[model samples]
Target: MAQDAKTLDLIAIGRSSVDLYGQQVGGRLEDMSSFAKYLGGSPTNTAAGGARLGLKTGLLTRVGADHMGRFIREQLEREGVNVAGVLSDPDRLTALVILGIRDRVNFPLIFYRENCADMALQPSDVDETWFAQAGAVLINGTHLSQPNVYETSLKAARAVKAAGGRVAFDIDYRPVLWGLTGKDAGENRFVENQDVTAKLQEVVALCDLIVGTEEEIHILGGTTDTIAALRAIRKGAPDALLVCKRGPDGCVAFPDAIPDTLDEGVSARGFKVEVFNVLGAGDAFMAGFLRGWLRNETVETCCEWGNACGAIVVSRHGCTPAMPTWVELEAFLSERERPFRLREDVELEHIHWASTRDRVYDELTVLAVDHRSQFLDLIAETGGDPERIPHFKTLALRAVRQVAGRDEARFGMLLDGRFGLDALAQAADHDYWIARPIELPKSRPLEFESSADVATELTEWPAGQVVKCLCFYHPDDEIALRERQERQLLRLFDACRKTRHELLLELILPAGMDSDSRTVARAIRRLYSLGIRPDWWKLEPLQDAVAWRETEMAINENDPLCRGVVLLGLSAPEAELLASFEVVAPFPIVKGFAVGRTIFYDVARDWLAGRIDDEAAVAALASKFKVLVDAWRRLRGAAEKAA
Candidate 1:
């Protein structure tokens, strides 16, 4: 079956089992004294954290088909976990872990997981369909210690990435699991314990993110101090975020440096909560980190959430039972704004490809409309190798047009009007096309005679069911006087009432003038009065906005409607900084812009007028467009990710 749409934001890929926790009532070890049985596992807890944080979460793990398995699945289900890919096998009872707390430390004992349900997990058990729907996939490092489970997890992680998802590896180092406790510290982990540091060391490099406790870090690095161990872990996951959970002292964070202006520091203990038990503290921290990481929170803030969630988990008795819900985390962060502000964004890596000289031409030929095709063929005849010519910039122009055609299905209609009543319906219910608007040199469309009584007709005008809308205003000309703009807004409001369809408005700010406080104030007032919201407002392009951070700030302050603004076609460092802003975010920015030259009006109308006959060329064009979209979307505001 296909993955559910309410698919989990975080998917834990590992063992799902039963954990029995018993505490010492005075000093005797009793299996039944205040014993608590709960569904527990590293991957399970991570999934729980994501679900509690209001994220659709799921789990893909192995568990016995007996009562223990049933119990684990039921427990996860209660936490809003999707169990579609949660495999159940009758071979072994669900893995069982018994933990006896002594002096605030955990001494956990486990039944062998060899050939067990979770350990029995095979590469055939999961697919890209499951991974593609998840925002992040968590893999247990301990599981990687075993050949079967370890190899299985590596395959799963690769599948997750192949499906366009992020992966987080939890280094839940269980020395006992590896039987390294009695062996000499210098002995090989694999030879002495059947599990080796060498294998784990290699797996460490494969993970996109790593989580480790101070002691685990010591075991991996053979260091006495946590900081030194952290440095060692950093070497393995230099590109991945290294999340180290300090026992009592608050967490430290490291967000990528964006040059000047960004002030980085370790987080302070935001809350002093009562401690209940420490067994699940690290797991809780991991859950919080996953939640914060998924939300795109800044480094320090992600740790802050981690610390808060960990504190709460430790304050409770049973494992996975102490996890706070998404609402609770949001409230916790709201109370501590210093480094706990919740934020999030999607992440993607960049790669520069080296292919053939005419690669661009070959790729773009796929998007050729009739005119573009004929024009391209002429160009090929004139400049391109009739057989093997290397066309440069001029060929690049045709390539760009071809690129646009390939995205025809996803093309959105962008109007230069003040209100995009018609565009929104088309994107959501119709084709997933986008509609944007160019800032008109005038206040509204040139078609408008003046900002006169167009209000009455607009108010009575029928509503549009489109999903995207574009609004244009000349910021430079300062035309469309505030009064006129306000009236123009009333017309938009009327148009909205005419339709029940959802729509996103793309308002284009004038190029020469990136921001106008007064203009923004006028637009906001009009929008608020109409009860209409703008999902995205394209302020000057990213390339143009970076140098004008002050303008962005001022405009945002004045325009409440820019709350959901997305700066499109951004190409500036400041644009990215603004995207990562704790309060303001430039989300889903339009990139890989496909526009025609002003000289092409005669032929541009037919840009979508053809079926590019070359299948390979068409696929290449589509792929290139997709690449551009991802690159452009990276322009975002500040975020909160863990260290």
Candidate 2:
């Protein structure tokens, strides 16, 4: 394959596994109460990290035919990585690593890689055509520890090299994986062995770029001295770019000869940031370095990118998730004096949260069935049992499914756990854009539905489920009332941030509050002044284009990254709602609508009154929804043409 034919920027062929990190910091793995699962493995992290930094990356590894395997594949796909090379092995289970953050320097971990799926990767699994499609291939040292995997990785490297592609090696020296240390000592960085050194040298001879820590370099060079180790590897592959990661001191790159002093090489100073867990910093460094190197950037720039990535990761938890996006990386690099405590930098944290989101809704058409009180009222009015509300919600989702079918990416649902638990589960399983209600229905001061500790309550919910809080707030309310509402909203915003859930703040004017174009916009501004930035805002439609622009400006000035706004129905008739859609459709910030009663009230009431069967109710609901969807799309189309 020619270099011009290379579709992938990088292909990482090595270990990929699920890492369960202890949630409680400074606690022993044995005493940890909970563990948060994240994608792990050095090469895997690098692949994901590279993708997050705008690289078209692929992972050439095997995962078991299990839920964990699906998770690894899905997560890589979510990161925009090519998963065509992530094969499934039926015989072996996926690899797993249990890690705990004891402190900044002490991270305890245990690998459960007894004949894991990734280790079972065969040389035949290396698709030369696929490998040739990448500009570069990265192989980790752990894969070179075993005879079988070593040959497999070697085949991948040779394929890439043969096709006018470069090869990079990460001297990921793990002694436990090499059988040089006890099985439980996964945290041990290095254990010298002549066999390992010989194998590493063979890999080093085939690489165009090499990266590792000083201890890793020592292991590869068959000596305890860092300079001597570099000299030995340099003698074998003298033209290779050797990068030495020096932890917090940053990193040094030797493009030619090994220098007497490490500082004599082209070096980039690391950021001064507090360390949270340093487990995956080196992987992050490799990813950041590749982002520059693959672009034919200077070694100094590569070191700068690598050092900054490592610093950012060390200040946070997990590996792949801690990897900064291109926007976040640029923001950090653009800083004149980077903050030492990176976690406290609200702007950076917000940027990370906003930019790293997997889902991006260009136009969201949501069916809102999260009405608890309204459903109960309907059941009572129809003399029907409230126990059937769950089934009704499930059927409502079925109606949504009938219209959405799987190809339509714009469809979403706003469901409540009280009556829509089954529907929520189904929607989540299908990976729909779901928003679940958190606030108690019709609460004046915005009280939570079940638990006062909304943060803890959110832990039980799926990470992708957006927390939708409906606040009937008005800026001109009495100070006491306004303060109470703001206080609860602030608490909810903080909780959403902590749980890593997107918040959809639905703000409505109290029954009557001098209605005007700027009412909702002012309310949004008030929330912004209170420092509560939601990922999304759900508002009632404004009367005209000027009102819509005011709301858009408020959101844009407050948070340019806000996920845009969706119109709420407020049980308006279909004609009325369609007119409102036309008025707001021209605005760029108005992303479709989330209307419930307008689409489902009549149909659901008729079903409960025995005037219509399930099929009739579903058809009626789907027809109403399709009308609104078509209207929104038609107006949006016209607006686009006008623009």
Candidate 3:
């Protein structure tokens, strides 16, 4: 009678723990400088991965009343995984695993799961009614190794089976967790034991699908021979889908069932990727497999999906956090470039992490004064002397604070390094999100910072800051010109990676090249093909909702993880700029606006002309900035109300 109003694609029951990975690569765990915490554990990762792949997934596990436990729950919920069945254990603490990447193949891990909250899962925690609310239920091998949790898993499996739900067993057999190996047993690929084999076989007999590595299968089948193992597994569960994961070679699936003498099975080749970490590949594979199986896809397609997911997870670090989204996977599949491009090893990682970071743009209003050359010329004209430009930087920063003026609105600014590093630092000190420009204007071809090589200059810049770089881009530009510009942008993208700075690529289609929103969208796609995935795209405002939609589709198709678009005010009048906001209002992809002259031009001119003092200029600039901010907010408010 375990039925709920809502049903899920898959419900996974077992271990959920926190993985604290050492950040310093190629170093021993003890020598690593820092650790990055991510939600981990086999069942938890599978649930999170399923949700990432667009499955309605849920987790049934127990975590301690601690910070790590809270983090695990929150992260699962954030990924759209239902955690209604994830219970809290007040007595025991959450399990923890510390992992270190010594090399592509060497990942040293230490599991601290002795008497953990997940192990404290009792039979009472099993909600039999919930079994009716899932198409499939998955129970891990490690969960069956422990008595209390084993009983809990058994009850859940029985209830699921009784409710006509398919049960999938993942042989997540960890030797160390089973107390069959020492702490130094770097990889627990297999552990041969009579008791363990019997227990696993008991559950394997009940599963509609059985997934494990060769070693796991050998143990479950109670033999070292692969054929013998297949026969034994088939004897236990003749209708179970048997999948044997063959590492980088991909996997083979006996879709209907394994036979006594299996000669062939549906197979898929794995994607070739430079492995960064190999910890979460299996769980990621299972997630993909489930997504395909539940959709009733061909066994070969399911294996292909599984391999693709594993490839992505291994190319990055950590477990649940490293699992790719549907959009990311599609992009990864469609684009096939060499594993290593110039500076790709470093840049791709940064791009992956930056794009995956949660970007919530709920009425974000950004003030951009990151103008250069032609835009700066007007500032010089207003100020009467180009030499007074440095002072304008200070004025701009002061005006930023004035505009925000104690309001708790999410505000951002795009400043340039030419005369604005100090202002950048100031804005950062006040904790305002700031973006600094790296592009030098009007060079023979799009030039980056001139003072030093791209890498050297970026190294000196402050860490954790957003960099803004512009290019005079047009899709129809001569091939040579386009290539040159793209090369320069790639260098800038690499520089951003080395500096650990987020990039906001400001793209301007030269005054007229049959330009429309579609042209701009094409330019964005072209950059993505060249592997320039920026954190934000600063685009000129399009005229209508249709154009905006086209541009958004391009961004999604090219770089699904792109940090959305922001309208750039090209020194337009305030009224005209506000009009642009109205046009962009219907498009959620246009997160906010980064308008320079519209907000600060008049105030700068009045102040430089000796009409208004510094204080008065600050007030006027703040007022103008606030006016635009209020206007943008009003549009957003109206849109929300309409929706």
Candidate 4:
């Protein structure tokens, strides 16, 4: 709040909530079993998106003194957004939204925000110092509809404008939030009341820029006609730049004068893309426009960036998490042959999430040694103490260090809690990523691991670590098997959600069904149909590029937010595994290889048999691991060039 060169570029004040989106497509909320969580609300999204675009943005709002409140603050900090103005209210609860994707057209949602923390923001909570530091102050229309928060928003806007800061208004009208009953609350766009119009016009006259859709313009201007409403808006905010968002038709901008014809004003063609969810498009457009407006760019360029950002968000899932960065926006704009439809390409999603992720992984080559009892049986012949099995995991950890020392690679190890908990704690500090296995081995019916329950184990692990679970599943037409498998998966999926840990599901086709591309693809789709969106798909190597592409398409089509697939080692020979890399290298979606037995099986066995020393086993495993990593890098380089 103090005077400093580190002042914010934009300060957005209004509603913030936890958006829980149903993963089941075309299903009613009552029947939904899985939901993806993200930071929601118009102003919150704009703050996060602007920060992602390299703007110094801050949010001035209130969240309840609970986990949700902490979540909002932590996410803002992680995205490099300033939260000095975000206060916590212990007297109320944070807002929550449960949204469903019934199709591309119908996204039914319910808001649970009665007496929420953000709505309870009093004038005393207003931080004028924060507003004074920003170049612009953004106000959401929803905030102006309330009495208490409305006064606070008005005070902040007046203070900022008086201090020579720009006041921008985003007409983010939500009928349900306004307690309107004349029409269907969720579908109401324009109510056209004299009192509402007068209140909005008062703020419109004090703003430098106004952004809204046709419906919002109708409400603010108190007219149903688009042209008349825009003219009315111009009369109030004579000098402010006006933006009219026309869904798929693109947006038109009025820098100074209102045009008689739609084509007369500066316009930018909208990026045509298949719409998955339209909830966050408007917020993304605002963030993109502000990026150019704050930099003093041409109206046409601003419109281009706005349209590009809107297109990217609508093609993906949630708002704040899916907003594209400047790098992604530029790359998407440069592509000449890219399809306009939201094809949900795994390769593209992988690149987008990895590039925008908080954790940096230049190149990942993970050594997965989460194998359980069957592995112990392999050492039974030597009459070795089964308790010494953990030493094998420690040997694999040494091998990870060996490869990491040679090249600057981001490595991860999938360790089992059965005997590798200490190994996990030790490996946690070496700049290595860790994924602990969660499923009990060799269970045809499938169950949680014997040692730790889902909740207990997750509570003990480090925050933000990955949890890997292996299941022997096949997509046969048996209803009982499918239902049983789905129930178990849902339980684990929900656990991961509550615990905030990432899930990597290693799916193996049972011994009977054909492991052909189509069969495997169907199995993957079936899992997704049940709303199982894993962070990564650990699969056995396919035969060729065509088959691998088919598998990639299946995973992408099911869940666009999925992180991507990682190759699994089914104990194939080193030569066979190397050949498989040549096939998958063409697909950028296959981020990196996560091989276990192929890299460590023989060396581990020799070490257990007393035939190899610790140093010898580590060197052997490291050498094999490097071969696969190098092969993957070569193929990935070629794929990137082709892309």
Clashes of 1: 48
State model 3's lDDT. Answer: 0.80
Task: Specify the highest-TM-score model's number.
Answer: 2
The per-residue C-alpha lDDT of model 4 at residue 419 equals 81
Q: Candidate 4 residues 297-379, lDDT tens each?
A: 89999999999889888987788888988777776787655666654554455456545656545457899888887578767
Off by over 4 Å in 4: 1-6, 182-184, 345-347, 361-414, 417-432, 437-643
Per-candidate TM equals: 0.48, 0.99, 0.71, 0.65
Give the range where candidate 1 is weakest over 10 consecutive residues by summed lDDT. 345-354
Summed backbone clashes in each candidate are 48, 0, 3, 1
Ranking by TM-score: 2, 3, 4, 1
lDDT (Cα, tens digit) per residue for candidate 3, span 400-423 = 777676742467777777766667
lDDT of 1: 0.52
2 versus 3: better TM-score goes to? 2
Off by over 4 Å in 1: 1-7, 106-114, 182-195, 256-265, 268-270, 331-643
Off by over 4 Å in 3: 1-6, 23-31, 88-92, 103-105, 255-257, 260-262, 269-276, 328-364, 367-492, 495-502, 507-531, 539-563, 568-573, 582-589, 595-643
